[model samples]
Target: MAQPTLGIMTLYLSEHSGVEERSYFRKVIAQAEKLGLRAVVFTPVDVDAKNKRIHAYVYDTETGRWSRSWTPFPHLIYDRCRYQDSERFRKFRRFRATYTRLVYLNRPISNKWGMHQFLATSARIRPHLPHTRVYSEHADLTAFMRGRRLVYLKPINGTGGRGILRIERQSGGHYLVQGRDRNRRIVAPKLVSAKQLPLQLAAWNVKDRYLIQQGIPSKLPDGRVHDFRLLIQKNGSGEWEVTGCAGRVGPKMSITSNLHGGGQAVPMTELLRRRFASEEKIEEIRKAVYSLGYAVATEVEGRFGRLCELGIDIAIDPDGHPWLLELNPKPAREVFARIGEKETYEKAISRPLEYALWLYKQHYGTSSSRRRSGAGKSAASSTR
Candidate 1:
């Protein structure tokens, strides 16, 4: 019998810039091989629906190397392509529409606003979300800021905490606008009022295609703003499970806790203990975060589709309340590495492979065949 194959797809893969990411694919390839599955790495350009084949770099476990070859599309696909290029995105759509039968671990959710709207359908997940609204008119911005002291204006399709602005209401009824500039440096605070908001916002030249969300005051003992990044993945049983989590402390005077924004990783439990005096309250908040993370993973997929994993960002307010900041389909494993949690990082890397194996067996009926074959036949086949 031919060994089952698993395909990992990304965008414009090259050995030069793919140095860090290639190590991850190699690890998954090795682990998948252990489960009697072959793995290959490819890009959208490598796919050829016209010929029913993909020219991919297949990982050979025998010699531990990658070699390019043409083969049929694997039964399972792990879509990691961000579709940064508009043209590449159109190609992905054509391929996906044709290969509708191939199993996908996680379907990419591009627009943050779209994901929020889907998640808002569930009452259970709605409260955990910060109040969010589309930004069109300056009137809406002023009205939202009127109720909350601080609100964030974020791009609808932004990632890595880029293009985010923190608008805060200051004393004497003035407003302060500060954020990371396009050059990735912290911008100077600008003062404005309700009357000046329109002109000031127009000066920035980006009031369209964004969202205004109420900001939660999640601060450390040292007064640095931070948020939690909790990793959740599906297990071998195909159930949602919390894999790993860490505290992302933002840079001084910055708005986001993104690693790209000069943020540092720290122990989440220790941070909670330092922020909250009572040990019992700290434990309570920890449990809540995990529960909320699991809920997000499940509810998001319930609305969207099957997701192999998610990185859920959470904010803990001063009152010990946890809010869902955002959920990431492509959660970076580096955060766990920074926090010195090697075990959790390895687990985070391994769970997707395990889930893929589970999906393979479920879709192919391998488990049931073994069950019906009994122990003797199963052992006999394994040795063969």
Candidate 2:
């Protein structure tokens, strides 16, 4: 029998190309090989919708290169595309509409403003969410920043901590604007009023398409602010689980604890232990971290249907309260590799493949047992 085909979909940047090479693809191929599945790579543009065929791309491990081949439409699609308002995404959506029964592993959530509005409906999630308002007229900023010690001006569509400004209301009745440069260096400037906000945001190349969020103090005693990147993914049985977590501590004066800004990734337990003297306090933090991570994933999945994974960023205030910063649909797992968490790092790579397979079986009534499944047990089976 032909193996079940699972396709990984990414947006193509080139018209002439159907496949792009990535280090993670190699890992996916290896994992799929053991699970009796053929892993195919493709872009939406590469699909011959009229013919119901795809110019599928596959990797040659022996030759260390990618080769294009023709294949039938995949049994299932794992959507990892970074969606945009462009025609490409729109066309893909139209093409996807033809397959009414095709299983989409996870629907993409790309709009920051939309996601915030949906998650806000959950009372459990609301406490952790920072007070946020859309940036529009000068009065919006003026009203939101009033009586706040610090506020963050973030791009509504920003990711990886890009295009963010930490505005502090100074005691002298002036505004302190601080942001990060492309080089990860701090770009601190002083602004006199809301009118100057545009001058500070001129570099961002945006106009009022931003959010003003209350800033929680996340710095520790050593003057370093840290963020916990908690990764959540679905297992073979189709359940949300917290795979692993690590603390990303930013440079001494950096606005965000983003790894893109040369931040250090440390084990979460180690950082919490050293920061908290009381074992009870540390245990409380541990519980809070896991609970919040699960809550965010489940809450979002309920509000926004069919999410296979989530990257939840939790920041701890000085008093030990965990604040949910933001949730990412596509999260980078390389930080675990840098931290030497081998088990967690390996599971991060394999869970998506396992979940993809499980989704096929669930909808198609295809049975795959552990004994017949050579893919072995999932990473979720291991203790973190």
Q: For residues 168-220, what per-residue lDDT tens digits would candidate 2 score against the true structure?
A: 88765677887876455777666656557656666555457888889998777
Model 1: how far is 172 from its true place, Å?
2.8
Judge candidate 1 against the unseen true structure and give its global Cα lDDT, from 0 to 1.
Answer: 0.79
Residue 298 local lDDT, model 2: 77
Q: lDDT of each prediction vs. the true structure?
A: 0.79, 0.77
Total backbone collisions, model 2 = 0
lDDT of 2 at 318: 69
lDDT of 1 at 182: 53
How many steric overlaps are in each model, in order?
0, 0
